[model samples]
Structure formats: structure tokens, C-alpha cells
Target chain A: SQTIHQWPATLVQPVGSPLSLECTVEGTSNPNLYWYRQAAGRGLQLLFYSVGIGQISSEVPQNLSASRPQDRQFILSSKKLLLSDSGFYLCAWSPRQGVTDTQYFGPGTRLTVL
Target chain B: AQSVAQPEDQVNVAEGNPLTVKCTYSVSGNPYLFWYVQYPNRGLQFLLKYITGDNLVKGSYGFEAEFNKSQTSFHLKKPSALVSDSALYFCAVRDGRGTNAGKSTFGDGTTLTVKP
Candidate 1:
């Protein structure tokens, strides 16, 4: 079975610091990867998605960015963290070949900017 | 483009009672709808989806959703609510079979509280 992994699990950063969150999927190749942020534990804000390596589509223009350096590895980054950038970051993956497959999500990372 | 609406922000139900969380959507093409559940501080879990076929689709943890094309709704339902079922629920929709099929628009989400 396929599984998605994300780390540092939790992080605390001072304002204006650089940010990097990593995600990877095992047991699947060429999967569609996505990044989302949830604030106040409600609505999900889509950050970015990638269909393949070196291909990333950003949904919202913000302080954050995403890159898929490998087929099953996606990374979310920020040059300088903003107070508003603090939230729970979730990474998800879906079958690339499926027309409408449901996304499988990782444990997620909690980021707090102080 | 596709959109999803979850009208209620919160729902309160007693344990063992029937529960329902409402959802509606819009899409340019055929709609592929999905339901997800999230516990506190956790990632959303895929509950179920509707691509084609049965209007009433059963999902994980004894939950189900009714797909009504006429109503443009896909409300999540469970026959008997459990205290453990208390969590957040989300509805999502996407265009089927064409461009942007992989991308889905999500609702604001609903908080379900199953009290004992």
C-alpha cells in the first residue's frame, strides 16, 4: 500500500525566518502531489499541486512556494515566514493515472511563527 | 470552474441519533464529488467519493452520502452517530474527465459534534 510522509511534525519559527517542509510518498511512482494549509481548523486553502517532477501549479499567491524535485518528493518553502503563514500544513497524494481518485494525506506538520 | 458549499458551520447530534452534514456543488462538466473527515490536529482522511453510479454511496465508518443531481447536493449521512464521530467534515468537487480533473474545490467544512 502507498503511504505519504511529512516532517518535522511540528516547528516553531521566529518571524522572517526561512521555512522548509518536506513531503514524500513511498510505494507509488508519478503520483499527483498537493499542499494545503488549514487555519482555525476549518477551511482548507490549497497552496500548490504538482502532476510531475519539475512541474508545480500554485493556487494562491502568497509568501509560500512549492517544488517537486523528484517524482514522489515535494517540498514547500518560504524565504521569510510571515505571522499569517503559521498553520497546519498537509501534504496529499493521488494516483496519477486515475481520472478521479481520492487524495491520501500525510500526518501533517504544525508550524507556528512567533 | 467548480465550487462546493457546506451551508452549516456546526452540527450537534446526540449519540445513536441519525446525523447529516449538508453539501452542494457546481461544475461545468459532470461532477466528481468527495467527502473527507478530519480529527483535531490531523490530516483529512478520504471517506468516500462519487464518480458515477449509485446515488447513495456508502463510505468508511458506516457513513454514506446521497448524490442528487437535481438538487446539486451530496450530503453526508450516518444512521447512528457516535461520540467518536465528532470531528470536521469537508465536501469537495471537481470537473470529470477533462481539463483540471485532478484539481478539486473544497467547501468551508462543517464541525460535527456527537454528544453522548
Candidate 2:
């Protein structure tokens, strides 16, 4: 069975500080990775998705960016964080071949920018 | 582009009563619909999906959804509601014939609250 892991289950950051969140999937190779953010009382917003290494697609242009450094490793980073950047960050993976495959989500990271 | 609409922002149901969370979708070609449940401050969990063949799809925790092509709806249903079923629910859609078939568009989400 495949498992997805996310680091820093919770984080508190000051404004203008740098941000980094990591996600990795074990037992799967060349999977499609995605980054999503959910604000309080709001729906999820897709931030980035990568079909392969070094290939990232931005669903929304914002202060945050994503990178797939390795086949199973994806990282979300920001040079300077904003108050609006505070939210629950989620990482998801889906099979590359299945068109209707469901996405598996990680435990998620809660970031609070003060 | 594919889009999903969850008309109700919140639904209230009593325990042991039948429950329904409505969802509708739009797409150019065939539509692949999905239902997910999210607990407080937790990630979304897949409940069920409608790919093809079956109009009614069963999923985890006694949840089910009926896919209606004519109505363009995939409404989540349960025979008997439980207080534990209170959570956030989301509907998603994917374009089956589009180039970005892997991409799914989600609705704003509906909050389901089952009273004890």
C-alpha cells in the first residue's frame, strides 16, 4: 500500500518569513502530485500540481510555489510569507495512468502566519 | 472546463433519518464525479466516485451517491444519518474527454450536520 507523508504537521510563522513544507509518497513512482490550500470555512484551492519531476503547473498565481525535486518528493516554498498565506496545506497523489483515479491526501500541514 | 456546484452550504438532519447532499456538474464531454468527506481540520477523504456503468455508487461508511446524467447531478445519500457523519462534504468533477482529464474541479463544499 502507498503512504503519503507530510512534515511539520503544524507551524507558526511571522509575516515576511520564509516557508517550506515537504511531502513524499512511498510505494509509488511517477505519481501525479498536487498542492492545495484550504482557508477557514472555505473550500480548497489548488495551488500547484506536477506530473513529473521539474514540471510544475500553477493553478493560482500567488506567493507560494511548488517543486517536485524527486519523483516521490514534492516541496512547497515561499520566499516571504503573507498573512493571507495562513491555511491548511494538503498534499495529494494520484495514479498517472488512471483518468478517474481518486487522489489520496496526506495528514496535512497547518500554517498560521502571525 | 469542468465545474461542480453544491447548492446548499449546510444541511441539517436528525439521526436515523435519511440524508441527502445535493451536487451538480458541468463538462464538455463525459463527467467523472466524486464525493469526499472532511473532518474538522483534517484532509479530505474519498467517499465514492462515479466513473461509468452504475448510476448508484456505494462507498465507505454506508455512504452512497446517485449519478444522473440527465439531471447532471451526483447527489450523496444515506439511508440513516449518524451524528458522526457531521462534517464537510465536497463534490468534484473531471472532464473525461479533455486533455486535462487528471485535473478535478471542486465545488465550494457543503457542511452536513447530523443531530443526535
Candidate 3:
């Protein structure tokens, strides 16, 4: 059984501060990883996705960036956080190749930029 | 490119009644659709998916979705609604392209409220 872990379940940061969120998957190798953000009472917005190490595709241009340093380790970072950057960050993984590739998500992290 | 549309923002239904959350998608090739559920302050959970085969796909917690190619819709349905079923539901779609594309487009999401 594969599982995803995201750290800093909750964080409160002042505006203009740096941000770092980590995500890792166990029991699976070289899986596809993704980063998503959701505002309160709104839908999810895809930020970035990685198919392999050192490969990252950003969807919407924002104050955030994602990097897959290891096969199963993905990190989301920002030099300075904006007030709008505050939201729930989610990390998800899916099989590399399959007909129906469904994503499995982690517990997620809540970030509040005050 | 693919896109999904969840027409309703919120659905209100009484417990024990049949519930339906509408979803429609647009894709160039064959569409691989999925349904996910999320609780407050939690991540999205995979409920079910429709790749190929039966139009109706059953998923966790007795939730099901029917895929209609003609209508370009994949609506999530449940026989009987439960108060516990109150949460947010999302519809997603993937375009048929690379072996492991890894990018999925999602809809705005629908909020399901099952009242007792």
C-alpha cells in the first residue's frame, strides 16, 4: 500500500516570509507527484507536477514553485510569501503509466500568511 | 486540452433520499474521468474512476458515477444520502495522450449537503 506524507500540518507565517513545504511517498518508486492549493470554500488549483526527479511542470504562474529532488520526495517553495499565498496545500501521487491513473493525496498542510 | 464543469455550487438533500452531483467534461480524445471527495481541512480522496468499460462505476462509501459519452457528462450518484456524506465533491478529467501524463484538470467542485 502506497502512502503520501506532507509536513507542517499547519503553519502561520508573516507576510514576505519564505515558505517551504515537503511531501514524500512510501511504498512506491518514481511515481508522479503534484502540488495543489485550495482556498477556503473554493476549488483546488494545480500549481505544479513532476513526472520524475529534477523535472517539474508548473501549471499556473504564481509566487510558488515546486521541485522533485528525489524520486519520491517533492518540495514546494517560495522566496517570499504573499497574502494570497495562504491556503491549504495538497500533495498527490499517481502511477507512472496506467490506463486509469487516479491520484492519491496526502493529509495536506494549512498555511496562513498574515 | 481537457476541462470539467460542475454546474452546481451546492446541493441540498435530505438524508435517505437519492442524491446526484452533476459533472460534464470536454476532451479531444477519449476521456478518463474521476470523482474525489474532501472533508473540511483535509486532502482530496479518490472515490472512483471511469476509464473504459461499464458506464456506471462504483466507489468507496457506496458512491457511484455514471458516464455518458453522448451527454459528455459523468454524474456522481448515491442510492441514499447520509448526513455523513456532507462534504465537497470534485470532478476531474485527463486527456488521452502520453503514457504517464500526470496532469489532471479539475472542475470548480460541488458541495454536497445531506441534511437529516
Clashing pairs in 1: none
Q: Rate residue B93 of model 1 by lDDT.
A: 94
Ranking by lDDT: 1, 2, 3
Worst 10 residues of 3 chain A by lDDT: A93-102
Considering TM-score, which of the candidate structures 1 and 3 is the better prediction for this target? 1
TM-scores, one per candidate: 0.98, 0.98, 0.97
In angstroms, give how far residue B41 of model 1 lies from its true place: 0.5
Give me the displacement of residue A59 in model 2, in angstroms: 1.0
Candidate 2 chain A weakest lDDT stretch, 10 residues: A37-46
On residues B25-114, what C-alpha lDDT tens digit does candidate 2 reach at each position? 999998999999999878889999999997999999999999999999999999999999999999999898867688888898999999
Question: Of the pair 1 and 2, which is ahead by lDDT?
Answer: 1
lDDT of 3 by residue, A9-38 (tens): 999999999999999999998898999999
lDDT of 1 by residue, B40-116 (tens): 98999999999999999999999999999999999999999999999999999988856777988889999999999
- lDDT per residue for candidate 3 within B1-116, as digits (tens), equals 78899999999999999999999999888899999999998899999999999999999999999999999999999999999999999999988776324578889999999999
Which pairs of residues have clashing backbones in candidate 3?
none
Give the docking tier of candidate 1. high
Residues A17-71, model 1: lDDT tens digits = 9999999999999999999999978898889999999999999999899999899
Q: List the residue pairs that clash in candidate 2.
A: none
